[model samples]
Target chain A: MDALKAMWETVPPATPDDLARARRRLIEEMGGRRRLITVPRLLVAAAAAAAVVIPLINGLGTPAYAVTKNPDGTITVTVNELRDPAGLEAELRSVGIKADVSFLAPHTRCAGPRFAGVDPSYGTRPHTEAELKWGAEHWRSLQVIKAIPAGHRIGIHPEYIRPDETLVLEIRDDQNPKVLWTLGAWLAEAGTPVKPCTPVKD
Target chain B: MTSQVDADDATLIGRSLDDPEVFAALFDRHAPLLHRYAARRLGPSEAEDVVADTFLAAFQRRGDYDRGRPDARPWLYGIASNLIGKRRRAETALYRAYIRSGVHPAEIPGAQVEDRLDTLAVNRPLARALLALKPADRDVLLLVAWAELSYQEVAAALAIPPGTVASRLNRARIQIRHALEEGD
Candidate 1:
C-alpha cells in the first residue's frame, strides 16, 4: 500500500499552462456577469437621459426591457416604450439569454413563441394540443396569451430553453401600462428529471 | 496577491460570491493533489479533465456549499470521486494494463536490485487486487491508502457512515493481504 501510494505520487504535476487554460475557461463562463457589471453600470447612468432624451431623437419605436422578480414566484419582464428592438436584445444578452422581440401595430394578431421542442437536433416540432395543454398545466409554462397587453402585440417563441426550466415573461399594454399578465412555461427536456421552478429576479 | 489564500475553504467559497477569483486560490491549493490522485486512477490526460471539471463544478455550486465545513478537501475530493466513478471502465483498464506490463507508466522504477524486484512482484498483484475489488471497497481502500484520508474523512468524502467505511476498508484490506500473500 505504501509503495502504491509512492508510485501514485510520482505522476507528473499539472503545468502552469494547464492551470491558465482552466482559469480562462472559468473567465469564459463568467462572460455574462462581467458584461452586466460594466455595460449596465454605464447604461444605468445614461438610462435617465436616454429614457427622456432618446425618445425625441430615436422616435417612440425603440424597445426597452426590464426583468424583475415578483413576490409570487414569477418573473416580470417589461418590454416597454420600444423604439428599437436592439436594446431589448442587448438586455437579454446581458442576462445570458438570446431573444428577439418585434413590435407590430395595435390589433395585429401575432404568432406564439417558437420552441425548439425537446429535440433540437431533429429540428423544430409543432406543439400538439395535449402537449400545449400539458405545458400550460406545468408550473413553469410561459403565459403568452395573458402576458401580452390589450393594444400592443408581439409574438414570442422560445427557440431554445433548457429542460426543467420555467420561463416567466410579463408584457403590459401601452396605455396605462402595468404588468397585467404573466406566462409561466415549464420546459421539459427528454431523459432529464423535472426541476422545480426557481424564481429568478432579473 | 489576495489575502484569501490564508482563508479557509468555507471562507473562500463565501467570498467567491462577491469576488469570483477568490475561489481560484482554493483551486491553486488543491488542484495539484487532486490531479495526482486522479492520474493514479485514470492517467494524466483524463486527470486534467477531471481536475478542470471538478473546480468548475465547485465554483458553480459554491452557492449551495455548506460553509460549516472549514476544510474543503473532503468536499472537493468527493466531487472528484464522483467524476472518477463515471470513468470506472478507464480505471479498471488502467489496473489491468499495469498487471500485464508490470509497469506503471507514472512510476519511476526503483534503483536498487531488491527494491525493483520487490516492486515488480507487489505492483502486479496490487493491480490485480484492485481490479478484483468492488468499486465501493476499492474507493474506501485507495482513499485511505493513497489519498491518506482518515476514516472520518473517507466517510465525509464518500458520504457514507464511518462504520460503513471501516467495514469496506476491512474487507478490502483482507483481499489485498491475500493477494500479496499469493504473490509472495
Candidate 2:
C-alpha cells in the first residue's frame, strides 16, 4: 500500500509546454462552437434563420416518413428516416391539417419565434436537468402534439387543433435508438404564418 | 494578466457560457495534475489526447453542469477516467513494462542504476501488483492513491455509492498486498 501510492510520486506535474497543444485545442473549440444546447434557447430561435434551405436526405428520393390515420380518428406520424421535410409538410396539409415541419440534423436545431405561438408550450428550453424534468412534466399534457408512448410516432389529435392554426413540429435526430429524436411541438396563432425552419449551429 | 482569481469553479463555468475564453481559466487550473495523472497511467504521449478530450467534452457539457458542485475535479476526472478506460491496454502495458524494466518510460530513472536496485526491488513489485488488479478495482485504487480523491469524490466521479467505493478500495488494497507478498 503506501508503496503503491508512492510508486510514481516523482513524475512531475505537466509544464505549460506539455499542455500547450491541448490548451490550444480547447481554445480553438471554444471559438468555433456557436451554440450551447440549452433546450429552451434553440426552441426560441426555431425560425431565426432567413436562409430557406429545406433539408433533403440525399441518395434516396422516397418519402422518409408516413402519416397514417389511426382507427380512432387520430393521426400517427411514423418517421422511419429523416428526409424530405417539405414532402412531409405537404402530406399533413393534404390530410386537412396545416403543418410546418423541420427535421434537424444531430447537434443542430432551428431558432424559435418563427411565428407568434398560441401558447408558451413552443419553448421547451431547460437549462438544467431539474428544469428539463419540470418541462417534460408540463409538456407531456400538451393537447396538440402528444408523443405516443412508443416508437418514432406522434399522435396528432385533429380535434384539439383550431381552424387555420398551423402545427409547428421541430424534430431533431438525437441519434439514440431508445429516445430517437427530440421533438418540439407547438401551435402557431390561428392568424399568424409560421416561417420556414432555420438551422441553428450547435 | 489573470482575472477571476477569486471566482469559484461553478461561477467560472457559468460565466464561460457568455465569454467562453474565460473557460481557459478552468483548463489552466485543472490540466497540469490531470495531465500528470494521465501520463502516469497511459504514458506521456496518449495523456495529451485524453486531457484534450476531457476538457473539450467538459466545455460542451458545461450547459448541463450542476452549478451546485463547487469543485470541478470529480467532473473533470470522471471524464478523464472514462477516456482512460477506453485505452486499458495501454495502461496495463505501462504497468507491465515498468515491472519488467524496473523503469517507467515516463519516469526519470534514479540517478545511480545499481545503487537504486533496492528501490527497484520494491517499486517493481508494486507496479506488478497494480497490473494484476481488475480494471474497476484499479480505477478506485488509483483515484484514491494517484489522484488523492476522497471516497465521496471517487463515488461522484465513478457515479457509484460511497459504500461501493469503500468495498472496491478494500478489494484493491488486499489484491495489492497479496501481489506484493507473493513478489517477495
Candidate 3:
C-alpha cells in the first residue's frame, strides 16, 4: 500500500498552461468584473424576510417585494415572490441603488450572456423543448437571476456592481424548470449610501 | 502584507467573491496535487479534464463553500473524486494497463529501476483489489490510502459519517489483504 501511494504521488502534475487556462475560464464565466460593494446593513435587514413564496403574483397583481430604506444608510429589498423583477429594480432605484436585475434560469438551456465556462456538473437536468423554446426568446429578458442551487434570492453575482456603476442582477425560480418570473430592477447609480428615512417621533 | 499563499482557502474564496482573479491563486496552490491524484486514478489526459472540472465546479460553488473549514483539500478532493468516479471505467482500464505493461504513462522514466519490479508486484495486486471493491468501498479506501485523507477528512469528502468511513475502510482493507494473499 505504501509503495502504491508513493507511485501514485510520483505521477506528474498538470502543466502550467492547463492551470492558467482553467483559471482564465473561471474568471470569464464568473463575469470578469470587480466585486460589488456589499451593503451589510441592508443584508442584515433583508435576511429575515428572504423566503420563497409560491404563486409569485400577489392577489393585487402587483410585483411582490418590500423595499425599505434601512436606518443604516442602506436600502433593503426583500423578494418574497418574483412576480416582476423589473418592478423590484424600479423600487431599488427609487431608493437610489442604481441597479439592474435579471433572473438566472437554473437550467442553462436558454440563450443569454455567454460565460467563458460553466460547471457542467451543477444545476438540474436539461430543459424540455417547450422550456428551451421559451428560454430562447426570453432568456436575456426573463426575470429570475438567482437559481435555487445558490440557496438565496439575492441575485447572480450582485457583487459585480461597481461603486460608480449600476447593479445588474439575474434571479431564478427555485422550482424545477426554474424560469425568469420577474424583471426585477435596474438602479442607475450604485455605491452611494441610501439616506436613512426621517425618524418619526411616536 | 499577507500574500495569497499565506491566506487559507476560505479567505481566498472570500476574496474571490470580490476580486475573482484572486481565486486563481487557489488553483496554483492545489491543482498540481489534484492533477497528480487524478492521473494516478485515470491517465494524464483524463486527469487534465478532472483537474479543470474540479476547479471550475469549486469556483462556481464557492459561494456555498463552508468557511468553517479552513482547509479546502477535502472539498477539492471531494469534487475531483466525483469527476473521477464518472470515468470509473477509465480508471480501471488504467490500472489494468499498468498491470499488463508494468508502465505508467506518468511514471518518471529511468529512475528507481531497482524498485520498479517491487512496486509493480504490489501495484498489480493493489489494482486488482481496487477493481474488485464496490464503488463506495473503493471511494473510502482510496481516499484514505491514496489521497492520505484522514478518516474524518474522508467523511467530509464523501459526506459520510466518520464511523461509516471506519467501517468501509476496514472492509476495504480486509478485501485488499485477502487479494494480496491470493496473489502470494
Candidate 4:
C-alpha cells in the first residue's frame, strides 16, 4: 500500500507547456473563440428544462409517444403512463414491455415555461373518457398511437403504440379508478384498434 | 487560486467558451493525469487520443456541467472511461501485452531498478485483476488508485451513487488483493 501510494504520488505532474498546448488546441477547436457558457450552468438549464418538460409534456396526459421504426420500416409503439400509473404499468407488462412506473402528483409543478404550448391548466384536469379521447385524437394527429399515464393522474399519457399492433390489457379493480393493472401487446403499424382496458383480479 | 478552484464547473466551462486561456487552464489541470491513466490502460499512442477526446467532449458538453462541483476531473475521467470502453479490445490487448512483456506503458522516468521491477510485478498482477473485474468496478478502483479521485469524485465521474462507489471499490480491492496474494 505504501509503495502504491508512493508510486501514485511520484507520478509526473503536467508541465506548463503541456497546459499551453492544450489551451491552444481548445482555442483552435472553438474556432479561436472561447466558450461563454459554463458546464454546470448548462446542466442546470438542461435539468431545469427536462424537469419541467418531461413531467409536464412527457409525463402524463400529453399527446406524444415514442415510435421506434424497425429495420423493415415497421414501427413499434411505446406508451408512458402518469395517471392510473399502476394500471398502465401492469398492462405494459402483460404486453411484454417491461415497465417501471412512478406516481407523480398533478399539482407538482416544475420551474420554467412549458413547451408544446398546451396549457398547464389542461394538465390539471381529472381523467375523463372525453379527455382521453381528445388526447388520443391529438396524439393520432401527431402520428402517435400508444398512450400511457406519466404520473399519478387520471389521464393516460401516450407512451408508444404501433399502427396495427394489438393492445395488451392488465387492469385491476374495474370499479376503482385508483386500482393498478397493466396492458401490453404488439400491434401493426397503422389503423390499430384501441382496446378497452380490462381489470385484473389479485 | 481558491476562488478559481472554487468556481463552479459551470462558471469555468462558460469561461472556457469565450476565453481561450480558461479552456487551457482546464486542460492543463486535467490532461497530465488523464494521459497517465490512459497510458496505463492503452499504450502512449492511444493515451494521447483518449486525453484529447476527453477534453474535447468536455468542451462540447461544458454547458451541461453541474455547477455543484468545482473540480472537473471526475467528469473528465468519466468521459475518458467512455472513450476507453469503446476501445475495449485495444485496452485488453495492451494489458495482456504488459503481462507478457512485464512493462507498464506509463512507467515513470528515471525510476530505481527495484521500484520499476516492483511496479511491474504489482501492476502485472493488478492488470490481470483489473481485467477480471466488471467494467464499473474497475472504473471506480482505477479512479481511486490511479486517478486519485475521492469516492464522491468517482461517483460524480461515473454518474453513480456514492454508495455504489463504496461497494465497487470494496469488491475491486478484494479482487486486487487476492490477485496480488496469488502472485498471478
Candidate 5:
C-alpha cells in the first residue's frame, strides 16, 4: 500500500505552458462577452430602475427591457434585448422580489451552484433527458423565468419564490430574432447570497 | 499583498462570479495535483484530457459548489472521480500493463538501481491487485493512498456515506491483501 503511494511520485506538476493552454482556451471561449463586459460601464446604481425599462435604444427604439407587475402577482419582463442585468435585478427587487439577473451572450452560461438552491431543482445534475424534463425544467423550484409563447417575455411567479430566497436568472442571447432567447432560472437558498454571474463556456 | 493567494477556495469561487477570469487562479492552484492523480490512473496523455475536462465541468457547476467547505479538493476530486470512472477500462489497462512489464511509464526512475528492483517487485503485485479490484473499491483505496484524502473527504468526494467509504475501503484492502498473498 505504501509502495502504491509512491507509484508515480515524479511525473512533475503540469508546466506553465500546459496550464496556459487550458487557461487560454477558457478566456477565448469567453472572448465575445469578455469584451462586452469591458465597454465603458453605465453608473447604474442610484438610477437603476429607469435602466430596467428604458435601457439602450435598439435601432428601432424599443426599450431594452420592460417589467410589468401583473394583476396575478406575477411579473412580466418583456426583453427587447439582453442587456442591463443590474437594472433588471433592481426592477425585480422593486417589484417586491429579491433577484439576480445575468444577460449572457450566445454560447455562454453562468457557472453554477451560483447560489445555494432552495430545492432539488439545483441539487444534482440530471443524468438523463427524462430526469431533466421531470426534475429541473418542469419543477416548481424553477419558474423565475419561463418563456411566454406569444412574445419575447418571461413570467416571474413570485409565488414560487419565498421571502428569503432570491430569484436567480441567466438570460442568454440566441441571436435569431425568431427564437428571441433562452433562459435558466433557480432560487438561491434563503439567507445565502447569490454570486454575481460569471459567464463561461456553455 | 498576496490577497488572492490568501483567499480560500470558497472565496476564490465567490470572487470569480463577478470576475470570471479569477477562476483561472483556481486551476493554477489545484490542477497540478489533480493532473498527477489522473496520470497515475489513466497515463499522461489521457490524464491531460481528464484534468481539462474535470476543470471545465467544475467551472460549469461552480454555482452549485458548497461555500461552507473552504477547500475544494473533495469536490474537485469527486468530479474527477466521476470523469475517471467513465474511463475505467483505461485505468484497468494501466494497472495490467504495469503488472505485465513492471513499469509505470509515467513514473520517473530513481537513482538507486538496486532499490528499483525491490520496489518494482512489490509494485508489480500491487498493480495486479489494483487491476483486479472493482472500480469503485479502487477509487476509494487509491483516493486514500495516492490522493491522501481522509475518510470524511473520501466520502464527500465520492458522494457516498462515510460508512460506505469505510466498507468499500476495508473491502478493497482485504482484496488487495488476498491478491498480494496469492502473488507471493
Candidate 6:
C-alpha cells in the first residue's frame, strides 16, 4: 500500500507553455488595461463638460415627471415636466389612462424640492419598518398596483423636494408588473404656468 | 530575502501585480501541486485550462482580496474549483476518454513496470469512484488526497464548514475504499 502511494505521487507536472497560453488568453479577455482607462477618461471629460453647461442652465431646476399605466392594458406614458410641465398625469387620467406620477430630484442647473409618499402599510408593519426605512433612504420606492382602472392617476411625489434635485418618474402596468416606462428631468420652479401636455398615443 | 517557502501568498500576489515577473515565481511554486491535482481529475489538456483560469481570475479579482489571509493556496484552489465546476462536462468527458484510452496524463513514463500497473489498477477504480461521488464530496476528498490540503484549507477552498469537510472526507474515503475493495 505504501509503495502504491509512492507511485501515485510520481505524477508529472504541467508544462510552462500551457501556463503562458492561459496568461495570454486571460489578458485578452480582460480587454487589457488600455481599454479600461478609456471609460474613466471619458467620465472625466463628461464631468468637465457638465461643469461648463451647469451654470448657464441654472434656475431651470430639473423637472419632475410621472409614469401612468392606462387601464386597457394598452400602454404607459412617461410625462416629463421640463418639456411639458403641466397637469400631464391629470390629462392622461382624463384620457382614460391610469397613471402613476413620480417626482425625481433636480440638477444644480435645475433645482427643485422632492418628496416621496409610500403606502403606510410598508412602514407600519412589525419587523418591516427598518427594512422599509432602509429602502426608502437608499433606494426609490416602487409602487405596485393590481391594474390601473380607468380615470385614476396614481400621484407619486417625493416626501419633499429639495434644491438641485432631479425628479425621476417611472410607470408600470399593474398586471404584468414588468411593463414599465421612465422619464427624468431637473425640476425648475420658474413659476411657468403648468401647460397642458399633448396626450401621448398608445 | 523572502523565501518562496516563507513569503505569504498575498504578499507574493501584491508584488506580482506591480512586477508581473513575480507572478511566475508564484506559478512555479504552486502550479506543480495544483497541476498534479487537476491532472488526477482532468487530463493534461484540461488541467492546463484550470491552472491558467485560476491564476487569471485571481489576478483580476485581487483588489477584493482579503490580505489578512497570508496563504493564497486555498483561495487559488477555490477559484480553480469554480473554473472546474463550469467545465464539469469537459471533466467527465476527459475521464471517460481516459478510461477508453488507457492513459492518465500525469502518469509518469519510465516508472517501474509493477508500480505503473499498480497505479493504473488503483487509479482506474479511484477515478470511477470519484466520478460516482457528488461534486462536493469529490472536491473535499481530492483536495486532501491529491492537493494535500488540510481540512481547514479544504473548507476554505470549498467554502464549507470544517466539520462538513471532515464529514465529507470521511464519507468520500469510505466510498472510495469500498469501491477499490470491490474492484468496481
Best by lDDT: 2
Native contacts retained, all candidates in order:
0.28, 0.54, 0.49, 0.24, 0.34, 0.31
> How many backbone clashes can be found in candidate 2?
9
Model 5, which residues run further than 4 Å from truth? A32-202, B1-3
Q: After superposing candidate 2 on the true structure, give the runs of residues whose Cα lies further than 4 Å from its correct spot.
A: A34-202, B1-3
TM-score of each: 0.56, 0.57, 0.58, 0.51, 0.59, 0.51
Query: Clashing residue pairs in candidate 5, if any?
Result: A112-B62, A112-B63, A112-B64, A113-B63, A113-B64, A114-B63
In terms of TM-score, the best-performing candidate is: 5
RMSD of each: 16.5, 15.0, 12.7, 20.1, 14.8, 19.9
TM-score of chain B of each: 0.93, 0.93, 0.95, 0.87, 0.95, 0.86
DockQ of every candidate: 0.12, 0.23, 0.29, 0.11, 0.15, 0.14
Q: Can you write out model 4's per-residue Cα lDDT over B83-172, one digit (the tens) per residue?
A: 998988888887788789876555556778897787777777777877788888877887888788999889988889999999988988
State the local distance difference test value for candidate 1: 0.58
Q: How well is each residue in A136-157 modelled by candidate 3, as lDDT tens digits? A: 2222212212333222234333
Candidate 2 docking DockQ: 0.23
Clashing pairs in 2: A39-A125, A40-A125, A44-A112, A45-A111, A45-A112, A46-A110, A46-A111, A46-A112, A47-A111
Off by over 4 Å in 3: A32-34, A38-202, B3-5
- Give lDDT per model, in order: 0.58, 0.75, 0.61, 0.54, 0.71, 0.52
Give the per-residue lDDT digits (tens) of candidate 6, residues A6-117. 4246666666565667645544433222110000122234445543211112245543434544454434433223334346646555544333333322211111112222
Question: In model 4 chain B, which range of ten residues has the least summed lDDT?
Answer: B16-25
lDDT by residue (A1-202, candidate 5, tens digit) is: 6666776666666776656656556544333222111111123323455433323327786677889999988899887777777888788778998888888877777765567665444532212333322332344554555567444677878887777888777776645333345566667778988877788886
Q: What are the per-candidate TM-scores when only chain A is compared?
A: 0.32, 0.59, 0.39, 0.20, 0.62, 0.24
Q: How big is the positional error of residue A58 in model 3, measured in Å on the Cα after superposition? A: 27
lDDT of 1 at A17: 64
**Weakest 10 consecutive residues, lDDT, candidate 2 chain B?**
B1-10
- How well is each residue in A101-163 modelled by candidate 1, as lDDT tens digits? 443332221232233224111112322333322321231223221233332233333334543
